[model samples]
Structures are given as structure tokens and as C-alpha cells.
Target: MITISVTGMTCGCCVNKVRDKVGALPGVTGVDVDLADGKVTIAGITPERTALADAVAAAGFHLAD
Candidate 1:
């Protein structure tokens, strides 16, 4: 599992969008969005960091450090 700190996820819709986008990526088996903490956990075959970041960005959110 990989935990990413995401910003700009303020509601259920945002969470859902993030989940959907990230979950659609290849090798992504599971995704959990924590709106309260602005975090997302992805469990899968281990995607490249850049790919993960791009997916998050494409979903209209920021993957924080």
C-alpha cells in the first residue's frame, strides 16, 4: 500500500473523483480516500511515482509531499 497526501479534496464528490481516476490506473488494485485527512491509499502492483502523481493531477488534485 502506498499513502499519498492529496490536497483540494473537500467533499464526497472530490473523493469519489479521485478514487475513480486513481483506481483506473493500471496496476491499481484498491483505493481508499480519506477526505478528512486529505490522504489516499493505493494498494497495487506498485506504479511509478510520476505516473501516480500524474493520475492525481489529472483528477484535479495535488499530491502533496
Candidate 2:
């Protein structure tokens, strides 16, 4: 699993959007978004970090370092 911090998520809708977007990416088998902690945990084959970031950005969120 890979855990990435994300910013700009404010509610359940945000969580679902993030989940749907990231979960749709290739090689992503699972996605868990923790709204309170601003974190997204991804499971399955790890894609490139850039791809993950792009997916998150496409969902209207940013990956935090």
C-alpha cells in the first residue's frame, strides 16, 4: 500500500471523488481516503508517483509532501 497526503478535500463528496478518480487509475486495486487526516491510501501494484499525482490533481486535489 502507498499512503499519500492530499489537500483541498473538505467533505464526503470530496472523499468519493478522490476515491473514484484514483481508484479508476490503472493498477489501482483499492483506494481509501481519510478526510480528517487528508490522506489517501492506495493498494495493489504501485504506479509511478507522477501518475498518482496526476490522478489526484484531476480530481481537484493536490498531493502533499
Candidate 3:
């Protein structure tokens, strides 16, 4: 699993958005979003960091350090 700390997600829409976008990534089989914790856990064959970052960016969010 690849874990990314996320920001700017406030509600279910944000959660679903992140899930849909990141879930579309190649080899991504599962996604777990923790809204309170601001964390997104991605599973299945772990994708490239850049790819994930770009997807998050496109979704109107960002992966935090």
C-alpha cells in the first residue's frame, strides 16, 4: 500500500472525488480515504509517486509532506 497525506478534502464529495480519480490509476485496486486524518491509502501494485501526485493535483488537492 502507498500512503499519502492529503489536504483540502472536506466532505463526501471530496472523498468520492479522490477515490474515483486515484482509483483509476493503473494497478490501483483499492483506495481508503480517511477524511479526519487527511490520509489516502492506496493499494494494489503501488503506482508511481509522480502519477499519484498528478492525479491528486487534477482532483484539486495535494499530497502533503
TM-score rank order: 2, 3, 1
lDDT per residue, candidate 1, 1-65, as tens digits? 98989999989999998999899889999999999999899998777878888988988998897
**lDDT of each model, Cα atoms only?**
0.90, 0.93, 0.92
Q: Flag regions of model 2 displaced more than 4 Å.
A: none
Q: Give the TM-scores of the predictions, in the order they appear.
A: 0.93, 0.95, 0.95
Candidate 1 lDDT at 39 equals: 89
Question: Which consecutive 10 residues in model 1 have the weakest lDDT in total?
Answer: 44-53
Model 2 residue 32 lDDT score: 90
lDDT for each residue of candidate 3 in 1-65, tens digit (9 for 90 to 100): 87899899999999999999999999999999999999999999888889999889888999997
TM-score of 3: 0.95
Per-residue lDDT for 25 in model 1? 89
lDDT of 2 at 42: 94
